[model samples]
Target chain A: MTGWISEFMNHPATYLKIGWLQISVSNLLVILLMLATFALAVFLPFPKGHDDTQEPRT
Target chain B: MSEMWTAKLRTKWQKELPIEKLLPDDQPAYVASWIYVFGVLTLSALAMIIASGIVLAFEGPAWYHTSDAGKFTNSMHFWSVQLFFVFMVIHLWGKFWMAAWRGNRFRTWATGAVAFISSIATAFTGYLVQTNFDSQWISFEAKDGFNSMGVGAFFNVTNLGQMLLLHVAFLPLILGVLTVVHVLMVRKRGVVPPIDAEPALSNRGPQ
Candidate 1:
């Protein structure tokens, strides 16, 4: 029984294998993405952030 | 005095926490169309997702996969995710067309977009947690595509344990942290006003 438990815990990879569309969630990319986000926050400024003084466009 | 503590605790522990403890007075100064609802709605769904995710994580993967209560909770989490992404995408488009980046508020807009991207990644990791047929299929298919793209070696999509840890721990952690930062920034600066506000501010700041 213990052996079964060990195998199940260790060999979970044997059961689940995600394909390409799934890997689009690549963990590595997640890091690159985080960095890119920080970059955008600092640089390209897409979503207008908090600026209370600006009045609404007429 | 003793009664006050009990009442406070009860208020805090109720099934539905009074989430809107504070109200926003700083209006957008413009751009208050129906389209803006998508952004706030997405944030609401995100709140639901985080709450449901905590419940499922505490239950453990196998229980959620097999038990009746667990299954229901899992479904709730799953549906919440669907809701999050759907509203997020719509919110993104609405923000985009509004040209929300015009003023000093660009940072907020950019940060929001970044959070959206991170949220999508978090969702992808989430799908791998279920040890069901769908999870199995997604795993194998993802491995091939990712391997071809050259990221499979480092991140084996077929690894259920890894996926579980990532979905419940890593991705959620990042998302939570980012969310905190996003909220803080929004509170500090307030939402950007309408496009016309920009010119108005420019005309007044220096003169």
Candidate 2:
């Protein structure tokens, strides 16, 4: 199990290249995750508790 | 009687950042979005990084390389930094889309941008100071880049002691100060309202 885990973790990084652009799979995954997280943060409904109807505080 | 300089300074500070504004009990209703949470999440990760880093610093590199507990602490520090950057970048993206610089808050945006850049530098120095084969390779590769930019003379990546001092002290100090100023600006200016929201909804002053 430890060997398998180590092998998986230590595998050579996979890269995608197109024209002048090249990126590792791990980095691409992280970028995608950030985008998905941003989308979720935007679309998810905010829980209601605060009285939004109150006068706008200046 | 003329007012004392200390008293005058106090009054100025209070007028600029009143206690209520500095530590408001509640945020504006619009601040309920999940996006707003990333800034605090980044801060939490940074705190973890600092705490773990402090332990590693006290134990030194040899301890971390040899001892199980020190290795664990080092791993914690490394992972915490990863989380910090991830959260910080997301927070930056959120702020960009929301046009957070609106409502005369340009300083807030500028400070955050500078802090991000500083963090990159700090992380680079951290890589150089790892005192391992990876660090050796990175420093060698980076030296030419820095030299081409004409900064290698002043900022020597090959010098482990200089890089370690920069990673542990100078860069962190600048990053910390920038983070503090960024957060303070956020508190002082209040979170920017949505791009199309009512002008009255701007949380610029006392809330």
Q: Best candidate per lDDT, number? A: 2
Residue range A1-58, candidate 1, lDDT tens digits = 2688786555434222466433333445544654454344334433555767576889
What's model 1's overall lDDT?
0.67
lDDT of 1 at B134: 79
True contacts kept of each: 0.04, 0.76
lDDT of 2 by residue, B1-207 (tens): 249998898888788889988898887677889999999999999999999999999989999988889889988999999999989999999899888887778899999999999999999998888889999999999999999999988999999999999999999999999999998998888888887775765545333
lDDT of 1 by residue, B123-184 (tens): 87787767778788888888998899898877889988887778778877887787776665
Please give the TM-score of chain B in predicted model 2. 0.94
Judged by DockQ cut-offs, is candidate 2 incorrect, acceptable, medium or high?
medium
Regions of model 2 farther than 4 Å from truth: A1-3, A49-58, B200-207
Q: Which ten residues in a row are the worst by lDDT in model 2 chain B?
A: B198-207
Alpha-carbon DockQ of candidate 1: 0.05
